[model samples]
Target: MTNSSGTITDKTGAPVTIADDPDNHRYTVTVDGVRAGHAAYADRTDDHGVAQRVFYHTEVDEAFGGRGLATILVKEALDDARAQGRKIVGVCPLVAAFLKKHPEYSEATSPVTKQILDWLKR
Candidate 1:
């Protein structure tokens, strides 16, 4: 069963919750009601005018490290992007690695491009 806020139990059995903070352009993950990590992203339009969500970075608190929180955070962020009809661009190494291991998300994944990188610099 899932919690109303979409909480799930992590490997350590702690209640984990992931939510999008659009105002900050990131998805935050919480463990037992405390913030654990976040996957940062930027919304932009691609050359073809397609909406894209570029995941640029992912970080978990030192105290929350090694708990599989980053994986959960990225998965939730990617899923959210897919649901919102935005293509996923994995600029962050962690996110890129996740995409490599998860082929199911390929349909929604976009290759990182020079234009996207330039946009991110600004």
Candidate 2:
């Protein structure tokens, strides 16, 4: 979408939107109003005494695949969590992979417990 700053967006005229939906326990990613991807998580406590969320799944719609939407979606989700003084546990394989590629966030990630990991499978 074109804002006051005159930045252009996708064909639908809506700029990319990313936000944490705490009620649903997932971060939603949208492209011009259409849901493009999401990063799912479960909330818990981290070692640093900060709130932690275990990212257990991340996915992009098949139509949105090959466009790096998942990467963008996950990055926004992770970045937002970090910005809020929260830590993340990368149980989601995609997120784990993302962390490896971006070590700058590695230190902010905490380990996931087996119980939490098992819960994610359900």
Top candidate (TM-score): 1
User: Model 1: which residue pairs collide?
Assistant: none
**Residue range 1-122, candidate 2, lDDT tens digits:** 34577643444445777778889999987886899889998877644466887898898899876666677788878988888777878998999999989989987888767866766677
Give per-residue CA lDDT, model 1, range 52-94, as digits (tens): 9999999999998888889989988898899999999999999
Name the lDDT value of residue 16 in candidate 1: 87
- How far is 3's C-alpha from truth in model 2 (Å)? 13
lDDT of each: 0.91, 0.79
Candidate 1 structure, TM-score to reference:
0.93
Q: Against the hidden reference, what TM-scores do the models get?
A: 0.93, 0.80
Instruction: Mark the regions of model 2 whose C-alpha exceeds 4 Å error after superposition.
Output: 1-14, 46-50, 118-122
